[model samples]
Target chain A: MSEPDGGTVGKAMTVLDQVANFGRPVRFSELLKDSDFPKATLFRLVQTLTQQRLLTYDNQAQTYLPGLRLVQLAHAAWAQSSLATVAAPYLDELAHKFGEAVHLAQLENGQVLFIDKRQSVYRFDTLAQTGQVAPAYCTGVGKAILAFMAPMERDHALRQQAFVGYTPTTHGAPDSLLQELDAIRASGVAYDREEHERGIISIAAPIMSDDTNVLGAVSIATSTSRHTIESLDRFEAVLRSTAAQIGSAARVWRAPMPANPSYGNSGGENS
Target chain B: MSEPDGGTVGKAMTVLDQVANFGRPVRFSELLKDSDFPKATLFRLVQTLTQQRLLTYDNQAQTYLPGLRLVQLAHAAWAQSSLATVAAPYLDELAHKFGEAVHLAQLENGQVLFIDKRQSVYRFDTLAQTGQVAPAYCTGVGKAILAFMAPMERDHALRQQAFVGYTPTTHGAPDSLLQELDAIRASGVAYDREEHERGIISIAAPIMSDDTNVLGAVSIATSTSRHTIESLDRFEAVLRSTAAQIGSAARVWRAPMPANPSYGNSGGENS
Candidate 1:
């Protein structure tokens, strides 16, 4: 029910999304290219957002990044979110167990927002910091959660925008993308298969509440050379059990926020 | 030159500050009680911040907390800041070496904004999560940085507010605080002897670049019962060496933005 069109809040979100995509404090000129946002509008939006502390304007770099206020907001959201905190110890254990990087991410606006992660002491990591966002159609955590969304909801989410191919192995075009999501649903697990970044592979499973509401997804990420299909199958069982431990523990902290007309996740206006 | 007086941005920032003071989100009535601001002001401010994605509104909890955008922003800042990346691995090593909590913090609004942390693998931990802010007057990392700030910058910063004491050990008067900072500058390290919290103790070393500009601070935090004065002396040498390694490594990635008149640290106006 929320308008996704360009407005102050929407444009501010777009600028932030650009920063997230690049994982850099993008210069204003660079943001203009992919965004196609008007120059003046972008400036005003960025300025206001910076002033409000929603964005950080680096005087030394002349670039835009999300501000401390933004981090605080994400902390607030995740604080209410059970999966991030409850799974912290589990993530560490899983990473230690597999000697790989394990991540827990939940889907928001059709993308995977990495809430927590633990990397093995000797793993090669591409530096995906916590709170980083990645596309849902390609990554294991993304695909794991995508498999569970109601068909219509999933369709609506995918239809919300175009998918950019991150690597040659990325699945694009709606028809093919939908087929892959369906495959994940059938299997109860998802594989990255180097679709996000070359040489990286991951195996993942979703966690659900006692009521069967999908909570989030967890993954064991590693270089493809280290994990074969058979090896991943063995890891998946551990992943699933680990996710269950997380979900059950999350129950104590992941309480539902009271419904208020003015606040909450961007859903249930219809409800 | 900028007014610190209350306005929309001020209301919004204060709202965030209040939310951070809480362990979790609180109801609007609770926010009113927690803050000196009026009810209507708090409500309107919460809605604006929620809409702008600076704060999250939990209809279920009927309370507001920091939002996802803030987490994204902090992560973004963490990603872009060379200090964070260079020190991350070493921070881990130091934490493992010391078998206690280690933290990296930068000065923001004369307070220590936690940039990163590694908790000791123990059953109990004292300090809060990643985005938690601690007073500069009491904490080791905060004192390390503040004690080194260019004099005028330091004075102007202290002029902006009152010192609300958090603990009996917290320094309440600005003059005593400045004197302590001066003594810390004469020495090379800063120590927090249960000044922030009653049972916690920490030793911090300032991270300085080749040109000796203060980059940030790294500290080893532990329970006083776990460490004695002799142990801290030995630990301080490790902290200083680790900070040097981090400072030097960060130099290779020093793509600092030009100092813009419009952009400034909370302590001083941009040059």
Candidate 2:
């Protein structure tokens, strides 16, 4: 992973990441063991973060966890910037219509970041949750967005892909993934075919602002026990419609803002 | 709100809060107009935040929104640290049982910060969403937790409250709220009675560790059209039971960790 180079703020954020990645109340010692910074510097950073309410210090546990402030800020992030808020009603509609899980995602730093999800009431265990991230080359949503991205942007995204074979059907190289992208462009949809995880399959469609600018992707995911890859084709029409609706809603939402010359018209990449 | 006081990290976080509070794609000029920091300092902070991916710069719109990294970190925060994850299944059960919206929240910096929510299929317009914050003096979950808090902590929390009359039922002073807290302590439940919102009412129970340390609060909320304040009594039994179960689950989840002297045994207030 590339380390942030924004000085003190960056260092503090990295420390925050270390605590969060542990996914449990982590000790300063445990963080120090894995961190690049020296003990004193790390200690001060953690202290500062705790003071800022970005890292909560568990008194009884003597460990650190990501703070409640993140939850507050994240709420704002989801409501304000994410396609999740715009896509919510549509996701609910799609999920209720099909009785299948629906996921809405956008590319963040060349990976697919799930911004929202609606689990089928029938299915209790869902692979994706809001805020989960997955490889851009393997997942249906990832591939759908990739297929719709501009060539220069697509190549940049592809270069970042590790191409790890997560399953037998997973793409193993850029060439293989690129081939699938071509097929997706033709079909206007992408299929996971259990590429990212065993028994999980999804049909995904890109949510685009126009012909070239990809906003995000939406997918209806299910287990192999429920549907075969060919059988998943039944959801194509509704899924595409939902994607288009979200895309249009998103476009209208952004239409009020004037375009900036510094960054082109495409919403291809955001930093 | 008190600004963070941890130097550069604090400044960056303040800038982040400014961006997030806008709840839209905000321009630097708009941020500068409302900011306490001078233009150069604010500009540097925003640039640093964008680089660190704590803030995303929209290329086309030439605006900033809280970054996707926050969503990722907040996911980890929610799963690992927030009571929301532990309380999710119980919230689901409560929501399903009553066919009403259930909210899980914790006290953060003297405010009620909703960490998770389960919206009833029967009710779509929920008053609280995960990550939303409200005054601890007015809301059901807020009052429930505050009633069970230690005097010192409760006083501190009370001081932070503005006592704004969101509705006529909202407590106008600490003395009035304290009297109600006493009643809540005796009843082992708190009722909103449309205090925070005119048409909405809720029954709440505090999730406590032992008899002293309050973990958080859970509430089942609905419109007054559906149930009167007296009618909400039917949900009290289940609500209390759910709170107990969550408290137990939370205790078990924290049992293995040793206490630190820097803070104390209580999980009452966290940074």
Candidate 3:
């Protein structure tokens, strides 16, 4: 067993997570309403976090946001934990070769997190900021990784999906998404047919470890005006080959995966 | 006053910071040598941090590195605290205009921290990675920001410099560096004359808020082989103007700076 007050640290981290969920500066009262802790305890915890620089207080708006130390630490994590570090050359190559925007994404707690991106030398605007998350049910990279996951893990991740309908073509329920996943599994690729946003499309492939475990996904995204769905199919072989190369390179280059102490043997080796 | 046990959280943070300082995975014994904590206390703290996923243990190497959750949190920090968000368009404009590598940097613990970078289309090998740290005395961005800092803050920052000679032209003491900062303050720009590393030369200017407080610094880095120091002077007016635009743009954008409770009234209003 850990220290008696170890749970206090957990509680403090929960508060930190809640603030990050907001994606913008939040007032103390706003945080208080959503947090489970009592007002006095929450106040003390926030004060301590502020003192630690884990949370910064803006005296002007009287709001709290994530601090710079997290950014410094995250840069280290990005260089190590994610595919961004290992796949940089591949991503640069794909971006230059295809002349399309390239995306590198990983699964974090069942959500699709965009870890890195290479903007097309040409300009087109969309909201895929490096840290931003998107629905697993409608995006190409999300579907590609989900298609390759072990059945139990895939089911668990599917259950976490919001299935919010952003466009009329969006998958509004699990059944429709499940049908697509089967096709994706057979083809070893996934497509986004303006399902998340109108006029946006992508072809994604899962990057797999040499052990055949899914590591992450890579995609070439473009506006519908540039390429039709049939034309997009031309990238399938090259896209999958790029993903495989990145995966194989990553497998040989990075450190061995560690077992999750909390999950014991039940947690798979992949995260 | 903060809680007496605030030191407990501080101690835990020290353990976290120690892992980050390594830049790569580190074994427990390696950390122990540099750590002030008793063996047992450090062990308990490491266990707690591992449980929290603030540090991930690589079982194969038996080393610890930063975890994914920290990256997720840092993404939030990078979006808010650093100039990455507000300066994106400005950075893009500068890169296209100068066709040179552009850097956005801020002072962290009296050292220069590169928060964002846009590489030149041409090739040159250098150590300017985003999220990388460098000494304050011999770099362009470092001197640019240092010249604008409040006197006490600047002096404290100066005391932190190692005064290590990286090259024959490098500043080896505070007196010479102080003289350069005076000229920088007057000229509104700073230059790195093959100081930190041979062949790496740059011209930099500080980004200031509407109140004329230094927010960060921006620079155009080039190799001495590519351009002479006098030829680099041609970018001076444009570089300063770009820095001014980013400063003014950052002024209207982002959250208000937080007051450092430790520094009392002397910490100033700009973050």
For each candidate, C-alpha RMSD in Å? 4.7, 2.7, 4.8
User: Over 4 Å off in model 2, which ranges?
Assistant: A1-3, A259-271, B1-3, B256-271
Which pairs clash in model 2? Answer: none
CAPRI accuracy category, model 2: medium
Model 2 chain B: worst 10 consecutive residues (lDDT sum):
B261-270
- Interface RMSD, model 3, angstroms: 4.5
Best by lDDT: 2
C-alpha positional error of residue A266 in candidate 1 after TM-score superposition, expressed in Å:
16
Model 1 CA lDDT for position A95: 78
DockQ of each candidate, alpha-carbon based: 0.40, 0.65, 0.43
The lDDT per prediction is 0.74, 0.88, 0.83
The TM-score values for the models, in the order shown, are 0.83, 0.94, 0.88
Per-residue lDDT tens digits of candidate 2, residues B112-184?
9998888876765766888899888999999999999989889989899999998888889988889999999
lDDT of 3 by residue, A86-167 (tens): 8999998999898998899888778888888888667896567677778878999999999999898899999999998899
Predict model 2's lDDT versus the native: 0.88
Candidate 3 - chain A - TM: 0.89
